[model samples]
Target: MSRSVFSISRLASSCRSRLLELLFPPACVVCGEALDRPTPAAFCRACLHEFAEFHPPYCPGCGATVPQPLAAGKTCGHCGGGKTRYDLAVSLGPYEGLLREQLLRAKKPTGEQVAVALAHRLLQQHSEQLQAADIDVVCPVPMHWRRRLRRMTNSPSTMASVIAQQLGVPLASGLLVRRRYTLPQFQLSPTDRLTNVRSAFRVAAGHRLQSAHVLLVDDILTTGATVTQCSRALRHGGAARVTVAAVARSYSDR
Candidate 1:
């Protein structure tokens, strides 16, 4: 399909979502109330107010919201005094309230609209960060093909496409790929999650990623295992820098 037609299709899908809201008047994904027009992540006013937002004093390296200012040169527990591959990771809200519900919805068969809306919200929230970071490409954490076929789509891919549209960046879905089929990371212990995803990704050969700054988009950053592995794959594939961005971050690192 022509690019213009493809864009219209996406816009049509978005409009369909709005129509569904008008017909059903979607209950707040969290608090169960009608949503305002131009909804952000399909949240209602009360639920938006209830969301736990993340703010500054975050670790510059890892981007986890620092609970409190740490001693100079100290790192957050999640960063764990070890280095991370990505330049930084930023999230809009904590993994609770409406934010959590929308993220979960993004995983469901019916969550595509929420995923796209959340991606737009994320891009708006990080406009400056994205612009300053010189993000040249957007790549989503890929799902294994078997899982992708069953899910009918990948939430991260849907989100990345929306982000690319808003930011005018190129969405590079084929650059990095999932090679292993594994159990859900959430079901595993933090340490096990890290081990489970290690080496699960590979970059497409001859992609020429060298010196390219990337925005790695995903729905949530829990143990950071998934992003870490994806970032490593990107760097290994010759990306100059990778910055992680997600809709929410899990409150506890442990």
Candidate 2:
């Protein structure tokens, strides 16, 4: 394009931004306060400051919050052992308060924007480690096709797209898939959670990992069953490493 055309295009984009700002002011998702400025993460400055978010030192294995500044190593009991087959894990924080509210909303079909925003929030919060993890590809914990068709939106994959784009990695979607639908983890006993998701996932046939390091994304981590099972499939299918990422993790209240 010519210099004149470039300048006109830039000016038109600026005008569109300004017009939108005037017509619909940006507001915080949590507190509904008008934002002085907004990024894709979308929370206002005050809410960002006041929110009780998760921070390290993270448990090296399961991504659970370790009370002290511990280095990465083994599976923490919070997620139980061996079952958490992923090499490492990271989470936005424990699911509670506004964070829990956000996740619950994301489960609905109308909550696509909420799901996308939460993915940005997770990436924003864990930017350093996630970006530095040397991940070759990103994939969401796959949903069963039947349920996905019924719901009309797959929140985890939707979140995974943002993560893959931000990380400059391929979104290896359908790399892992549901073999059969299982009951929701939250409804079962911790032991049942294990058996429930066991054998529920499998690596899709043509997408062999060839030992690539993978970052598996999920919207929530409750008992850790689903993700661990997903990781098992990835590892068994030849992934060199598997790390799990969740937008929120639910800890037992007791």
Candidate 3:
């Protein structure tokens, strides 16, 4: 049975690859370099290396860049002082430069390819975190149904699903549901931001969620209120522990 399943999976993957080549083929999000043949989903060799590297010995709590030789990994003053719900958060890097442009384009109407590419890059950075963490299930920071209907895709959820697939973990879509369509968070003040996202999410009760360790996935972590709200919902729905993983972490006061 296992053999049959593996064979079927391989066949399905091959078919998908062929289809991708047939229509809307893969290209590097950075330089428009061809990426269809690359094993890892990213830009060409040069552009891929240009991405900022997040090495270990960093803060396990916030994924913040920290100077080494300290008692622990890279930890900022704020995280060490405490005020976060999720035990830890990991991000690939700040969403700036080419990375930010690519991510924004992906969220736009005609940037599906960029989204897929960024999802691949995110997996490469977070794979070890996924394996080492006590994560039993994966959930995405969902977009409101109305926004999803208008945008035609939930970029964060799509990226999360791809990461889950790569990590061989279960992607539970129905686990976390958005409750309200708040205004664009960028324009809101910090206080209003928290208020806006408060009670904005709910996790459904089910076999996949009860007492499970969840990794909440998203595209970016800015003020972190979005992730915090999502984590609250997951915890309220009986998540034992929740960890956040994002493609980029916006650096405040940088």
Highest TM-score: which candidate?
2
lDDT of 2 by residue, 104-219 (tens): 77878987877888889888888899878899999999888787888888899989999999889999888997888888777788888889999899998888789999999998
All candidates' TM-scores? 0.80, 0.91, 0.82
Q: Give the Cα lDDT of each candidate.
A: 0.79, 0.81, 0.75
RMSD of each: 5.3, 2.1, 4.1
lDDT of 3 by residue, 1-254 (tens): 69999999999999998897878566665787776475557577777666574566556556656676335333466454445778678877666776677778778777766677777877777677778886788888888888888988777777778777887888987788777789877777766778999999997655446688998888877777888898888888888889888777765432
Give the 10-residue window scoring lowest on summed lDDT in candidate 1: 29-38
On TM-score, the stronger of 1 and 2 is 2
Q: How well does model 1 score by local distance difference test?
A: 0.79
Ranking by lDDT: 2, 1, 3
TM-score result, candidate 3: 0.82
Report the Cα lDDT for residue 80, model 1: 74
Clashing pairs in 1: 28-33
Candidate 3: segments with Cα more than 4 A from true spot? 1-27, 34-37, 69-75, 78-80, 205-208, 252-254
Q: Which stretches of candidate 2 lie over 4 Å from their true place?
A: 45-51, 81-83, 252-254
- In angstroms, the error of model 3 at 243 is 1.3
Clashing residue pairs in candidate 3, if any? 58-74, 59-74
